[model samples]
Target: MARDRRPPGRRGLPGLGKLFDMVDFMYLSGWQKFFERRLQRYGSTVFTTPLFTKTVVATDHKAISALFDTIPFIQDYGFGSAVPPKPLVGDVAPSVFETGVLHDNPKAFYFSLLRHRATSLPAVFEEVLREYEVRWASRGRFAWRDEIETFTMDFVLRWILELKFDTAKVRLIYNNIFTNHLWRVARFFPWTRYSRSLRYYGEFVRAIEEASSFEAIMEIARTFGISDRAYVAKQIAFLTGMNSYLGLQNLFKSIVGELSSRADIRSDLDLQLRDAAPGALFSPRVRAVDEFVMEVLRQHPPVFFIFGRAIEDVVLESASGSFDIAKGERLMGVIPFAHDDPEAFPDPASFQPERFQDDEARAKLIWPRGIQERPADTADRTCPGKDVALLLAHAFCTALVTRYQWTVVKPITWDKHRYSLNVAAPMGELEVAGFTIRDERAGRPV
Candidate 1:
């Protein structure tokens, strides 16, 4: 099959009628490979008609950096439009994706919620781990992924807003509203499904409002001398639950699956956890967890691509060559490609935690750029929950390694077909066998 080498402008592109076959093919199959191959073939710059959307995908670091730096040349393509009509995050999804403006103040307000004082995620994390230890005490060997999700969901609801419900019931409701029938319906009839999702969204918003007294949360904010509960809620919805849930769930599953398979990595992680003083499950050794988690993220980023629409026509210079991108053109910073670039990260494919061991290597690892660079959580940047997500990933992994002894019950593999947009666990019985480590000092499992 000859490739459609249309010129840069949209006018020369194939019509929907002529493009439907390609669209359907890409939408349903080989999308990740399609993007990966395109990145390889075009040397970090290529155009695709995936989902009938005209998109410019850039795998070049210079291009990605330029896209991040040039404000006028990049715009947020909010979550509502990206994954529209899906329950849990329909058109009303709260994100910079919904609001075009950077909204830095709002982003900061939301970031604060994930921090310790206000929403108490750290405390919640500790409590959940303690509860999980007790729950798995006598089981000896257990499926760790399910337990982790249950714990994470419970913590997110309890500390974030004090939402109360039966754990199983809440999980079932959330799965239905976010993952099960809603996802299937949205796939088949997007418009109707999305509209229905909005109804669920309304219920969720109401529930959140009910769970957390808006006036009281706001008063707490004011007591801290900070106002704006609405903004806080939006931020919380986006960061604390919506964004965090997808990534954390995937991260928990992926990390466990990988640890179960790779004994060396697992042993190293376990040793690090054990070295920590007893009852220090949530302490500084968590940094080791962060490093190991980063390695996993590099291998399998939950969101493989970060995108920004060009705000104005611009030229991005790269080691390979210069490319002219027009205003309104969409640029997808292909994260997997960048992460695998050997120049930035030598031997990118090998699961070597030591790759990030050196301070210099750590500095170059741009998963979350520092303040001098564009903060990964900048309101303008697409991955706003980067810090929060990393923290959660670190905490979750450390808790698992420290509190339990585990082994893979099945081989872990990434399912490219599961979600066209994000990396997900391969469908099947994805299980891990683990036992809570008994700590005699505490007279219970830790």
Candidate 2:
């Protein structure tokens, strides 16, 4: 990683260097704003920055596409923040990447568990959402984002693992997490999030390890060298609890918030569901809901930031100049930035699922193969659980907006600097006055 081959990139906010950049990126929505701006000025190429030990920032389509090819090896550095997680791979679960050294990808087998329950997914989701709706109805007003995270996590754990979690217990963990995050900044949030998720997921790991039907799942985890009880506990908890929690929370927020704000969309969606008949709330034939979900996924991607560290020198050519990224250099692919790339997704910020409703929409796509792509099951590289996630997402929306009418008491306002705490306070609990919904029967703004 010689300095001469590396393109010129800012180290930080002068004097502060990486520290300043970390705060801006992890805390404030710094890089999200800068990725597009920098690409316009710098063109598509890798540039070394103090942000990571050695780093490459690629904002172009080709450069970004090459990154997934390096997956399960180019380990992520939590998107190269100066205050990286102390545990290194503290993301809710222990996957091949989190095990320190990469092995044959375990995700393929890990996702098989979901396949067994695929046929019953919609019914399971309907059950969970119906129960959760009862809870929401009981409460006059509550933090919708906060409660939604809990309900989704509970549903995911139960749906994926067949564990019956007490809703009160789920709410307790979510509440404590929110409390810890409010007192901290960007760097501190991961610690709070992990500790809380770890505490509960620890029990989950043990339960599964002891279960008669779960030895096969444990064997699969063992392939990744997650055999030790302690490691198993963390890994299982992460996989079952934390890993999917973030995505579920984001998807829940985007869909619910959009439906809350857009009466017309809700009306149209409800009409479709009614026409869909009973038990077909999530039917693919329901184009309005399917396209709406796609739009939300594109605009508010579950994993908003992507970071991959190079284990060997990789060559990447750009409009500016070609650069051979030295081993150990970190590469970043801000997914949201790529989605917002004007050339790829014209009117990137607009809510237009129709952009992907036809052949022209396919041309607008920048990512051809990824669970991160529009259609969930299109590619091997796509998230294995994508279809299931979409199914649950549709079930969630149908249970809410499509099944009944509602009113948004107070619209949510997102604080860009909400950072790590975004999970607990996805909309910043302080300002995130959960859209106080009026009683469904009343259908009047409170």
Candidate 3:
């Protein structure tokens, strides 16, 4: 075979580097560091390597921003392959041919519903916060990640379902599907495919399908003229639940942790919320709080990478050079690297919320779908619920600061330079002992 002409990268284990990429994509904790280090070492922002398939990892901020909207680079959900291939539970894959749709209608309906319901989120969040507040205040210190995870799960379920369901049972279902050890282990050992957690995932999917019978969901199905109401419901639930649940947990944890450590930022935040009336408490007229949320997302994006497939042979032109990618090839835009690119973000390493106070600088902050200024759309596969996510985060920050003042039980430190790609480590770094909270208004222990 003629030597494969491609931009060079770490050719992991063997067999076109499939095994290496699999481990790096899944089991490897800080897998993104490998991409970053390789990009830095090879002196190229765009380099080809074997990831789920032959992949071109693009780290240049401008290149990535343009590629997200480019026609050739389309969204790929990794169907009929390893690594969470079956995102839904059904014989009919949720694609154009199978579902007679391409997620546009369903996503549009869901996004509209979520946006319409956005006004109600403040009340919902306050209710959920109160429930946690009682428990957290009584104990004084709780496992930060565990508590926040539960809090987010409750909020997501209630907001999406809007039905009276057992919160604890629903939490169990989500936990088993997402974080259960045995279910994860079963993936490696084929014989253990019958794991109970795996069964629960199936059951959870079915439950979402059954939930279509609810009046709230029926209204969505009726409005969209969707014949397969069950399928639409399942897709909406999966999109809204998993992505928002996981993303919000990280966002919430990071916001709380940041405020705890940075006294100056916290003090500034306190002054901003000082004069808010009850009606304005949830949606405070505050710039610092909103700016702080944007900075957190830029510095520590909840989803590190946005992946897609190349639908046609195309050349990605970056300042580095034009890199060729073949049809059917996989690609990932490293958001962490793009957000930290010096050309885009000055003093990228420092935490500065003020950077976003400017409209031009704020527009540069890109999440998975598109730039901050642009609304998400189905064509680009940008999450439609992007605004809703920001709304909830902003409201949650207001509720948290106004409700209580918190102190870390043990010092929590995050070294982004060393472990930016380690998604699972930050939450654990938040220790349970010695953390305390006090009523901000009353100035007494909660």
TM-score of each predicted structure versus truth: 0.78, 0.75, 0.84
Candidate 2 lDDT (Cα, 0 to 1): 0.57
Q: Give the TM-score of candidate 2.
A: 0.75
List candidate 1 stretches off by more than 4 Å. Answer: 1-29, 40-52, 78-81, 86-93, 100-102, 115-119, 137-144, 166-203, 220-239, 364-378, 382-384, 420-427, 440-446
lDDT (Cα atoms) of all candidates against the true structure: 0.58, 0.57, 0.66
Clashes per candidate (backbone, < 3 Å): 3, 5, 2
**What is the C-alpha lDDT profile of model 1 across 168-207, one tens digit per residue?**
5444334344334356555566456444445545565566
Report the poorest 10 consecutive residues by lDDT, candidate 2: 79-88
lDDT string, candidate 2, 1-446, tens digits: 43436665775554577665566566554545545445555554455455534456766555666666544335444322333232322333345333323322456445655666577667777787777766766665576766777777777767666677654544444334423433335334555554555455445556656655466666666755555555554555545554566566777787877777677778777666766654455665576677787777666666654566677776665545667776776776656656666666777867786776766555434322342445433123345566667766777777676444445566655444444434212254322323333344333434
Q: Which stretches of model 3 miss by more than 4 angstroms?
A: 1-6, 10-16, 24-29, 82-100, 164-194, 202-213, 276-281, 414-425, 432-446
What lDDT tens digits, residue by residue, belong to model 3 across residues 180-286? 33444565654453354345556665666666435566676667666676676566555544567766777888787777778888767766776554324555458
Question: Could you tell me the C-alpha RMSD of candidate 3 in Å?
Answer: 4.4
**Number of the top-ranking candidate, with TM-score as the measure:** 3
